[model samples]
Target: MTKRNKLVFAICAVIIGIIAGMVFVFFNQEDLINEDEAKAIVTERYGGSVEAVEEGADDDIYIVNVEGDTGTHKITINRHDSSVEAIETIAKPSEDTAADDSNTSQEQNEGTENDEPSEPEKTEDESDTAPSKKEEPAESNEPEILTVEQAENAAANEVGGNNVYSTWSGEGQNREYYILQIVDGDDEGALVSLNGVTGQVNKVVYLDVSDDDYGNIEQLIYEANTYADMVDGRYIEFDDEYFDEEEDDDYEDDED
Candidate 1:
């Protein structure tokens, strides 16, 4: 063969090899994830609508796009096994006006107090409960117990509420004893930990309530359904409820 012809053939071979490599990478990538799992994972992580953007081959990966308040996320998954390979996020304007609504709700809640005398008295009663040792778990490693006054102050700072009832105490996995309870009607109280020797509220969760028995699971389900409709799918579950007589009795004993 002529030198020029041979050179041309070699160049063509190199180009073909490169093309083949790319094809292999694109086609032989990995496992396959079904549409349902992809959607569920995306929704849980990003809290939005997840739509399939691209499908993958038998051994290739699928790509999905999740739309959320902040932006859009591109998630790649293995086709054969349905595991996530990569995720890319793109910023976009928020779709839900939750922030604005939350602020308005807070303002309304604050303003309504001025029109009612019973509300202030109720708040005072709730706050006076104070942190009690009975709520502490038997195996707790609480270094120091917080005084009722200190607990009240901590709760107030965390959520602008004067009635911060200290309900339960236990050693959290983080090497701190957590004081847990309900605060405000819609808010979860907090988990305050104190220094070994200081009676102080070390940590606070403005809205952190634990799951209750949700008595008559059927009732809970009905309530959840009603709430879902009321909120128009904006909220899926009811995290708070009116204290049951039994629960109140339990609380009274604990308080004592």
Candidate 2:
């Protein structure tokens, strides 16, 4: 055979080998764990209902990021055999976890007023000497702004969800608007950043809520990333395995 014929045969052989390898891998692995089963396993092992469960890199494994009374547990399940691959426990639960941000901040700030130093009391002798300066009404120049209710309406209009709740979350410049939490209706559990002054809906962080369907999780993650892109804002975080950039780069290089 000519050199050209040999090259064609070699290319075809390589293609066939790749196809066969993929088929072998697929067939050897038993059925993967369903959403219910995966959650059950996580709860059994980690001692709580699974808060946030995700399929690991390319669906090869499953990830469960859950926090309980003990602490946070990140459990990995091999999709092939439906067995636990590794269990990592964090005693502190320091990461940007699945736990509600609103709840966390409230707990942190409730006791802050007590932590400040109290002012010293005025002595009877010094009180008489102290200047009795007359107080003047300050002039107001700030522009009229949207109310919290109006901001919540704007956020709900921007994203189709039940406007469950909203709170003044930040301080100073950071305290632009109410951080709105929408849930139950259309948008799973969305964290909407609403600009109270300008009445602009800024960023939204999509989150997972347990449902009968696993597609709920997929849609939550997809919207979380895609919607963030639409507004040029940041979305929610996922495990490293969920986005195996190295594996994707390798596949792209191979295709080229």
Candidate 3:
């Protein structure tokens, strides 16, 4: 053969081979499976025997259809491990099934009716005979209000904020409580607690003291005026009255 003709024939053969290979792959793109493993997967998912209607390739996924008591399900198994990846139910219960359920319910109702004893109906006159009067609900008791002195004492004792603190009593949630204010050298804040009660400081929190002079007990009383409005009364008391007495001894030594 001529060189040109031989080259053309070789090229044609290569093209035909490529086309055939493509067609084979397109048609055989399903996973190949073992018969025993396929059956096991179906038994595990649906509790029934599975039939392989079609064979799949090595790389493709195997699809199996399982028939159950209620419906037919489609399950896909992996060719490599025989593990079930997906399952879908295909059949639905028919109208005759629904009608049978209704009939069963009706029979049960009829049986219950025959077993139960019916009570005699009362006449209109019996219902009309004297309706009993319902007693009114008792009035709710008001919470006791705290005295001004009691509120002041409670605020001075709670442990928080500054060394020097003051207290004021007020009414909240229908209950009497005391608001405590503390003033350290730099930090100033306040707390609220129930009057004469331990550990109930829900309402009042610490107040920020921006002014240095306001740390005095008198200023805390003025700032806590709002708490005073809610209470029976308000008052201010010093936390450290003996500080001056203690300083007097030191002052006498300086003179010596």
Candidate 4:
């Protein structure tokens, strides 16, 4: 085909591919759980229409959430057969009347209090009948963060370093961790991370830095992780179409 025609063909092919993918997805959605059926099942048992229907990540089930005059409920149903798998009461709207009930309960409690005798004040002369219960100790609020010694030991055991060069603490996903620099053994140029709380080894990394990179080893490790993340993100998209010289030439000719 001519250059202009070839470019037109490539554009047409891309559009067709996108449309085909959309049609496939649309039809496949019809085979999954029906939201209408889920609503009907919830309304029959609970006397209310379903508020929302959400498909679960699991292939076989759907979550049907319902809100009614009396309460709110979460119902699980099978995707293929529409059978009820589980029902859970999430909230009770009926509890709104609790304020009026509480007032009546308070009046009754006051009447009972008037009729009952008060306990005599504790006396120094009278012996106590029951001993007071001891209070338990309060838990510490401080996090179980890793210490340098613990991090060094954990890294040493994993990488076989007799001594630690340097250490620093940092935060990981849910908790704190420590990275230790190792030397005097086979792990001379290795870096290791240890969990702050459990003292378990988290990661081991190596770096062969030149004189120009950095004298500070910790900064180099951080930069290495950042570079690795960048390289990883580059592969997240597979754009082989960019390398097609035929398409490029066609576009260049059309522009000219």
Candidate 5:
């Protein structure tokens, strides 16, 4: 062949090779596990009812929604390997209702008990010419903020985690509190926020370490620290209607 024809032939051979490699990859790529398989894997691992399973942002990932006894969880699964990537807690069972019921019962029991009023007392020197003295005002009653250890304990009580990976204690915009990173094993964990004054749980958010590069423990602790720095120790009830109000208004405007 002539030099020019030989060069063209070489170029065409390289292009064909590239096209063949692409075809092989497109046909032989690893197959992803189905939605039912993903649900079974999550249900077996997390011991919850799999409410729904949806495709994730990536083609090889699945997001499984589960409702456990303690809370609702959003579990991420790697469909190719059938591995759990992350578990995010969307909701925890409310303790306020139970607390209120107990308080009411205690108040009712106390109300049934009768108390006797004390009689007035007179001193022997009441008639004496002693000068009357001004009484000092009562000391101010204030709630005491809990220590770091107490805050950690409070968090542990709310979430049944055997290990506390990390703890951050500081005063936020509204109150003083502690945020703790807790985990059961390598995969499951939570970031717990405890009230410093009341020793009550403020929030319990599940850890999502799917994108963590440093490892689960390190990333979880880092997340706890970041959350502690940003939390203002304020609890606000989340309502879906609140978010849709603007959308509803726009729809009404369109009708008019």
Candidate 6:
């Protein structure tokens, strides 16, 4: 073969190889995400540091462990689409009972230390001149109030919800109530208020699913829970009774 023809044939072979390489990459490239990306996604959604990320049973799925504000949870993500598939709570944060006790003790100690300096021993004439005062009768002790857990249970029982997103205790102008943001397995969410002392459900305001243009119930729950955080100011109050007759029926059944 002529030298020029040989060179041209070699050039054509190289071009074919380059085209085959490009086609292989286009077909075989999967949009698989990495561990760092999984961590970022989880942190953004859950607001916590990602502890670890591991491969799931399937190559396209990743399980990310996160220590979030609410609890330690494992978030499952689809690596291909970078979508969160499931979030399972491993454990909820425990109440800092020790810290509360310490604070109470500190306050008591401060009160004791801050007692007013004893007035110089009053002279006999001064003591005699002090206006005679009658001691007021001692006040009676109040009844024990319901605990947070009991309040949550009462609210959940009334609403048929299983998951509690947040809870707050406050005294409004009219009454003292425990407010809870709860959601059922079906993504139905509601804000519930109940009497703190009596454990009676006072009101329930369900999330407006009809107007959920975003179609993300979990996000909706997060937004709805912010209402409970506004304890210092006014909140949604309801005077109408909520599921009281049903509670009465349950009590009757228990007695039977």
**For residues 180-248, what per-residue lDDT tens digits would candidate 1 score against the true structure?**
345456444433433323444444433333345223433433333344345433213344453355578
* CA lDDT, every model vs. true structure: 0.55, 0.66, 0.60, 0.66, 0.68, 0.68
Could you give candidate 4's per-residue lDDT for residues 125-243 as a string of tens digits?
56576577889989978666666677677777776755535555455434534344444444335556556778766555554444543466556666544443444432122222333
Q: Order of candidates by lDDT, top first?
A: 5, 6, 2, 4, 3, 1
Q: How far in Å is the alpha carbon of 179 misplaced in model 3?
A: 54
Q: What is the model-wide C-alpha lDDT for candidate 4?
A: 0.66
Instruction: Please identify model 6 stretches exceeding 4 Å from their true place.
Output: 1-30, 97-256
Error of 2 at 175 (Å): 99
lDDT (tens digit, per residue) of candidate 5 on 1-256: 8999999999999999999999886764546788888888988887969888899776779999998767789999997788888989998857885677689989887777635455667676864655778899988676566767777677777776654454454554345454544355554556666666777676666654333523555545554545545556443222224325767999999999
lDDT of 3 by residue, 24-102 (tens): 8766544445666677767886785564544456445667877755667778778666777788887755778778888
Q: How far is candidate 6 from the true structure (C-alpha RMSD, Å)?
A: 39.0
Model 1: CA > 4 A from native: 1-31, 56-59, 95-256
Once model 1 is optimally superposed onto the true structure by TM-score, how far is the C-alpha of residue 217 displaced, in angstroms? 94
TM-score per model over all chains? 0.28, 0.28, 0.25, 0.31, 0.29, 0.30
The residue-by-residue lDDT of candidate 2 on 123-176, one tens digit each, is 999999999888997987765666677777777776666765556544544555
Over 4 Å off in model 2, which ranges?
Answer: 28-36, 45-47, 55-60, 91-256
In the range 13-105, model 6's lDDT, one tens digit per residue, is 999999999988666444688788888888887788888899988677899999855778999999878999998999886678556767899
Clashing pairs in 4: none
Better of 3 and 5 by lDDT: 5
The clash numbers for all candidates, in the given order, read 9, 0, 8, 0, 0, 0
Of the pair 2 and 4, which is ahead by TM-score? 4
Estimate the overall C-alpha local distance difference test score of candidate 3: 0.60
Against the correct fold, how does model 6 do in TM-score? 0.30
